[model samples]
Target chain A: MSVNTTQKKHKFNVIDAVILVVICAVVAAAAFLLGSRNAQSEQNSVTLEYIVEFRTIRDEFVDNINVGVKLVDASKKYSLGDVVAVTSKTATFIGTDFTSGQLVYGDYPDHSDVQITVRSNAVINDSGRYVIDGGYEMSVGATVYARMPDYTGTGYCTQIKEIKD
Target chain B: MSEKNSAAKASGKKLRLNIIDFLIIVVILGAVAGIALRFGVVEKVVTKSSLSSAYVSFLIQDIQDESANYFVAGDSFYSQTHSAEFGVLQSNIQFLPAEAYINNEVGELLKVYKEDRIDVRGVFLCEGIFTDEGFLLNGTSYIAPGSTVHVLSSTIDVTLTVTEIDAVGAES
Candidate 1:
């Protein structure tokens, strides 16, 4: 009787061990799949910094211009209104001291230099350069426009300069 | 003699069971770690960079029916070229739209993600420097007060005059 009990206990122990191992294997597999998916999603998205310059055509004392802005590809289908994500760190303004009443006069004021740093995600080629939807390399002076979220009129006013990703 | 043999067998079984239990625990812990790593809960430490803050405002027009849902606080606004920029930093409507009041003095304060024309104000944090134009936040230039900012939206174009700018200190 003792031997029989011992043998039965051993059999139950084996079954429990098998079940535990199987569960662990399943869990590990699931985690691995989830991790792979997360990595792939990260790879599909790229963050890039774009250095933009905006010059004031006229001079007026303004406190600051705080609005949603974008750099669009003018020569491509993007002209129909497509935008990229400008990172908070890169979306900014630079130029004359507005607080002191410095104005941009003449053709373009010497202090009228407005440098905007914009960070966005674009389809980068294997060479790691930004390309439009048609896979055209974003060239220097490609007629890019600085568009704002203006609900009343045409928003494209400033052209981009010195774009460096 | 048979009783002693049986006792020995039982002890061996216990030992084996303990080993299996330990292995199971290890596997479980590993699985948990994997999940945490994937979700960024157990991120690796890296050097931190500096960030700056600025207060900004926008005069947005009436929202169209289709795009009304995208104007809520916390909703990210990207440029037409897929560049993520301003986020909806503030909205008058907190819990319910009916509960909020619109102040016309500061322009029509509208509920977030609602179809209305209103003036929205918020703050953004980014890397910038103090330049001749004003305080350069990110790459956009902030001019002095009274300057006209031509805002171009998909549906309409509007202009907003700069009112105020307060740049916070530089800290990591």
Candidate 2:
């Protein structure tokens, strides 16, 4: 009896390999392009919220409470942005006790102190104080005044105390 | 060897290219080349027609009496020099006041002045693009956060420190 043995050889396909390499290259190129686009956008623009807090030197009461008060810079020639919102809290202090049989001099009471707290958002400007839209200067100890809308009474008579991001 | 055996050997050694495989290669190459060409052709278009709002904060330090003349605090600040052509867009500044903590229990007004730096916050709408880094105003490139910008004023030399940058329509 004769024994017949057949050998089989494995063949590598060059076309399949080339296809895979092409796919990988395409994916890599796409990723690079998109990544660069994102990076470019990042270096372009940014948005921020500007917050500022000020206090009223004297006691004030307003009907609408949003109008009349304006923030001024140190130059006293320019005006800050419009007062977006104002948060105020009034506190009364009694210096002398009101007796049942005592003479009252002032309108309400002699021993009373009023404190006002206000936080507002001003107009947004570029990254400098050179030419603000309203053209105002803002800084610490920058004297800011608040005027009454229509009623003839004292408004905000104070300066800026604290500023935050 | 027989004639049939020789024919089988010849067939086994012959290289065969399928039609489907060739078509696939051509399609893939075409698509990739198309994409690359498109990417190179298209330019990044920045819309300058619409206006976007930006919020910013900064500090003005050591304001002297002589320079204080240029610092104006009022309803609006109209730049006599700028605001015409070749200037920043319409914007405004709102001076933030310090907080006063009063002890209502003792009937005393307690005010604390910490730093000499004046804190200012502003909101402005201009033709610019919003990006991850900061707001970029059109027709200019100098304005950016953390950069000290100087305003040309007659009385005083005004300098500002950009502290923060926030884009409009983004989550704060």
Candidate 3:
């Protein structure tokens, strides 16, 4: 009787181990598949214009973000493309400083919204996500660090559009 | 007895699920969620709900006279930190000489206006939602009075303290 009880208990533990492994494997596989579904997906390359809106930049950098300047990805070191249009306005931000212990709202001093429209070739996916410069993915609100010939700034890819050809 | 011991050892060696295994799986899932949010995959997902309009006032201090010319009314600003509009500059902008407390000859700290510096105060018509945690810019960013924020515009970048907030549609 004792041996039977021991054997059943061992079987139960074996089942538990198998169940846990299957559950963990399923979870890890789902996450991996979902993220990489578009990593290497390439349907076609097209002219893509995306806007990178810099957060807090000085007036000098805004003015210098001129037409025809080339920009590259600061992190991945991939080609971002050339500047096609540059538009700027007043910049606003959720201030990081809370020393006053309250929420403060206001205009960012000496800075403005520098929206640089960069045109480059991107692989368009079926799901509308563009893979730019062969590696970096272009999606709305993706934070990008753009390094220009003479300047560099951090901003979000606020807009993306595929130019029909 | 020896045979039973061998059987038990065999079962143990075959990889039984332990408390540590459950913990490791939980940690892996949590890390995946953290990565998604950190990389901004679901950034716009959380911003779709709860948006409204409001007004924000800010007080900026210590600007040189020449630099103070940049704060203009009727200007609109966009938030760089979040995907939301910062606010529209109202005509209620004002600038005064910046005040500083300095030690006089008698060692008494006297508040006096600095001749070369000016302080700016202004109001903005903003589009956001007001919540118990102050105003949420585009329903994601937070703002409240007394916190210092670096206000960025197309023309200037400066730090300003939030002075007040008023929700436009709370009662409506």
For candidate 1, write residues A40-76 as lDDT tens digits: 4456445444454444321221112233344434223
The TM-scores, one per candidate, come to 0.25, 0.25, 0.40
Model 2 residue A124 lDDT score = 33
lDDT of candidate 1 over B56-162, digit per residue (tens): 44333333334434445544343332232432344542222212233223233332434333443333232334443244334443333333355433343334443
Rate residue A16 of model 3 by lDDT: 69
**Tens digits of per-residue lDDT for model 2 on A1-165?**
322235454454786677768776777897897776456445532221222433232332223234335433322324444454555444343332234433323222212232234344433334532223234434444344432221112233344433554
Residue B124, model 2: Cα distance from true site in angstroms:
5.2
What tier of docking accuracy does candidate 3 attain? incorrect
lDDT digits (tens) for residues B41-139 of candidate 3: 564355544566777777888888787778788888766545456888889788889967554343333457899899888888887665432465666
Greater-lDDT candidate between 1 and 3: 3
The interface RMSD for candidate 2 is 17.0
lDDT of 2 at B120: 46
| Cα misplacement distance, residue B129 of candidate 2 (Å) | 1.2
